[model samples]
Target chain A: MSEATSELYSWRASIIKKQLMALTGLMMCGFLLVHLAGNLLLLKGSDVFNQFAYLMVNNPIIIGLEWLLLLVFLMHTTIGFRLILENQRARTKAYAVRSTVARGSKFAFISMSVTGPLMMVFIIVHLFDLKFGSEYLVVQSDLEVRDLYRTVVEFYSSEVNVAIYIAAMCATALHVQHGFWSAFQTFGLSHARYNRLVELSSDVFALVILIGFGMIPIYFLLGYS
Target chain B: MRFTLRIWRQAQQETTGRFVDFAVEDIPAEMSLLELLDSINRGLILESADPVAFDHDCREGICGMCSLVINGRPHGPGAGTTTCQLYMRSFADGETIVVEPFRADAFPVVKDLIVDRSAFDRIIAAGGYVTVTTGQTPEANDILVAKENAEEAMDAAACIGCGACVAACKNASAMLFVAAKVSHLSLLPQGQPEKSRRVLTMVREMDQSGFGNCSNEAECEAVCPKEISIGHIARMNRQYLFAMLLSGERS
Candidate 1:
């Protein structure tokens, strides 16, 4: 193929990958919100949270949805990896000689190229630690949901893990802070009034995720009985 | 009022350029930006310094020759206003203004604030015309065009071959300029004979000219004196795709 054809093909691939990443990433954000809500049941004591975990595990429809979520997660990660590589290739030059003054939203959107991958690594480690590790899935019993809570608490009690979690949560916050509103802009849903609403929503969601996730670790660190 | 002007000066195409500072006094607020520069040039001539050379014609803003990056914006701060139309009143008194030529790989600086935008001409020369016979003039309105289509074509045709869009773009992309030309001619029935070939050849020439790809950041639109929408870009992409597919069939 000619160089133009190759460039065109790669450009089209990057555009498609961006669309896939946005769709799956937004869906995963929804999952995170729901997942966090379910996890918060641990604050109510072991029985309440374990019952919630039991319902999720026992429902056949929920089981199918879990697989769907897994598929979306994998698709998101694969496309995200492709996007990062393409972005790097597009910016082969070391630094920009002429830097334009970009709006705040544009700056945050561009920086997503960096934070997306960091969040990917955090997601993998998180899944491995809680889902595949000795907490819940290895035991195959709803009772280990309580053990999962204790493991989470114990994990956060460490300064290193707390630091990592805090850092990861901060990355997540920035990612969602830009991602949420940007998705709307990409889809052409930007009116001035609605644009402000989307911006507000992005900030609120980012704050909730940062404080919500960060607080979990701090809760244990603070000796919450 | 006196104003400090940081103007880029280059002696030749191969010579390195630098910002040379000059102060101009007693400039009227009603004076357009080009007039302000003229005042500075007059001062340089008196001082036996080489007067700055720039391009301008038809100070009415139709000629598209007055291209300058004023205050870090293409055509200054006025929306949908050409540089020649921007008056000194828009800027603060005694303001330090930086002025430079439009920088792009396709457009190289010739001297002072002037750059050779001949790449656009070459892209147009590639295939921007209709392949109609040159015998006799056709009847008036021989091809019935819809009013909306004619209006859109006129809007696109209003582009005066200015490199403002390219200057305003962060990536220095010329997609808007190419799109406007292609769209203007492609929309009419008289130009239909060579529409597909025109888009394909012109787009190929545009790419070969080393202009960067359009990332749809809308900076071009923001600073476009014509206020050309990026929608023209989408239309251009669609037209190019159709041309490619049809040209493949012809081959």
Candidate 2:
């Protein structure tokens, strides 16, 4: 009974679980956009970057928002992993030789389960690399704040850092390619013809995540810092 | 055509099953897969050997009675065709065709190439019908359905309640089947009276039947004999969402 029937039993419970997953996933996607914008400030020099980072870390509302974002992240991952396990359990007896002729982004479609854990591991490693990494303090606006800009630049300066980031962003991009439009589909908003608009936007946003986050490590690796 | 057919064989509902190969010969290209099975069964009967048991009623494509996983693709090869309609020419002349029962917890194998699909019957029984009855035949024009809605309804109505969608789905999910059932009815005015109740209870039964959640992979749509689209699934989600939101109304 490790698999919660509530997760797969009732239509109400199942719908709510997927709804929560879509909501939390969209919230985190929004956070990724905001985080990308914040990190891009590193190009503006340590002073401006530290000033913004310091303000962000010190603001009570921002602290609360960060905690809420963590909660959302946890919810998305937990529901996703459980559903993956439950789905696999759905067919205990396997086909001796199974194949699918269904087309249209099947790699991204099936890769969600794989990318779910990849993103989790990447996020944990990413947090440890910067958020809880060695803190360097510098005077910004007549106050000592954590020099997150220097930390970021120094961390991404390594070729290893850049490589891991590129791979992580690729995985995220693959996941997002499906996850973005899938969130809308989960909410019952889809069109046979016009869903292409949402599907295209999903692809575009995935590219944005890849390029926006991916540029940082490569930018620093190119010795821009 | 000559071929080796590895057909699954099980004596009873509780018994274990395994593939038993038969080297079938002198099959005409025009013979349907089910007819080929008939020929093989006759040979087995003449030899006093146990014949392979499979489900097949109407040899035509529409009945949804024929079920087989020929070489992993349900209903054999070719798109939008059922096993009853699949001809021997679709396969290589001497290829080994592997046939197995549909695998899912909800669909236990009753015999060779016949998984019990009563779960679908139960899901339909739950809420797939309209409550109001007309004693006499009514004029079709009285309903006044939009052209597009009628087309979509007809499209969804094409689903034959075959378990091919369930067999072909990696998760063995029945969303496509249930979606088609829910949608064809929900799109019509005659079916409007119990719309909310229909979606809610049918989905509840589906969940209880031990079918997996839809991951939107859509192999169900691909392998469906009728080529039922997953768009109905999205519509089902929409209906289910509103049904849950408006549950207390008992519509």
Candidate 3:
């Protein structure tokens, strides 16, 4: 009540943690959108897809953005885990039998706790197969540039890898389904008329990201590679 | 009407409690839940038994003093109505009703159907008031306010500080109560000065009181006697974030 000594610092830290979560969530959602758009280029054939990948890694501006991307992911994940742990600690005892009478989006609320850690593992495996793993690489065009297009196609050509990729994309979709609009709400960007539009747009965005990335694995699995 | 009641009874704050069953017969259908309890208490007194010690004041439903979780629903089955407003007719004849005190780590059971909700009072005390000069009242129109803003502020102001939201929440979070208080003040012209500091201080008290974080469960809004929306929680989150993240200033 007095804005006492120890409590003030904890309050500041809690609010700061929530803000960081929203900021990093927005950044990661943006990254997912751009990543989806670029991945869609794979359908246009190997030349265009490889060229896009080549430019993404070679361009100084885009390369700098990757570092920023890493920073955002690091902050988002670290703070997310901290908030989850703190929230868990806040409730001293669990109800003998708990039931939610509120008309909550139960799927969205419960799945976030699952998809977040799943996405973390998915990102690591995804980077290894496409970015760092050299076993799947193919040399192309006399310039000897690594053919990232072949790397993606060959990686997905295995049924096991394709299954893993699809599973990860599903987790991403579920995470964004809740995270997209939640980030906006956390920032206080709500109105009676406009919030409905935001919710609709978030659903569409989640679907597009999932389906767009979903096609590549299906394409390679279907012998189109 | 005759009904069976299973009520939670605790010996003290340090001991465990359990449900004690009683058959309450010959009750009128129009009797309010509190009246039904009163009838049961009179019967117990005649038998030289310890009567239930639930809290109540101004049983007409405005005081927010009545706290009961009837049939596992806070404030009974009705939406936007308190326990005192709930009548015996809401339940069928010869039915069993289970009543318990609002549960939360911060709200310990004081006795049968009573909890120490002083936690809410502490949260309100943190920053629920505006600092004003000691002088004559200002003219009503001295500070122009938008009509819509006034209405919204009044809506948030309808909260009775009842612990239904805390009881309804799965994690026993008090976000709705805090949001109502925060937005009620922050929406008005007089509340602008301490807007940033108010949110920062109140939320800190909420966390320190050992209440859980809001998972957007929305049970609070569902069971609220005033039907306060979770939208206020969003507004509180926004204000708290903006104050700490962008301004980077204490006040």
TM-scores for every predicted model? 0.69, 0.93, 0.86
What lDDT would candidate 1 get against the real structure? 0.73
For residues A1-225, what per-residue lDDT tens digits would candidate 1 score against the true structure? 013442222223222344456678788789879977986776776556666766787899989989999899899777666555543432232211233433334543356656778888898898787666555432334344435665666667788988988999988888888777655544335554566787789889989989877787687788783
Candidate 3 wrongly placed segments (more than 4 Å)? A1-12, A101-111, A147-151, A154-164, B1-6, B20-29, B39-49, B91-98, B135-144, B245-251
Measured by C-alpha RMSD in angstroms, how accurate is candidate 1? 6.0
True contacts kept of 2: 0.44
Of models 2 and 3, which has the larger TM-score? 2
lDDT of 1 at A216: 72
RMSD from true fold, candidate 3: 3.4
Q: What's the distance in Å from true for residue B197, model 1?
A: 4.0
Please write out the lDDT profile of model 3 over residues B83-162, one tens digit for every residue. 99999999999998888888888898888888999999998898899988788988879988889889888999999998
Alpha carbon lDDT at B237, candidate 1: 66
Clashing pairs in 1: none
- Per-residue alpha-carbon lDDT of candidate 2 for residues A151-210, written as tens digits (9 for 90 to 100): 898888888888988999999988888788877877878787788898889999999999
Candidate 2 DockQ vs. native: 0.45
Model 2 residue B187 CA deviation in Å:
0.6
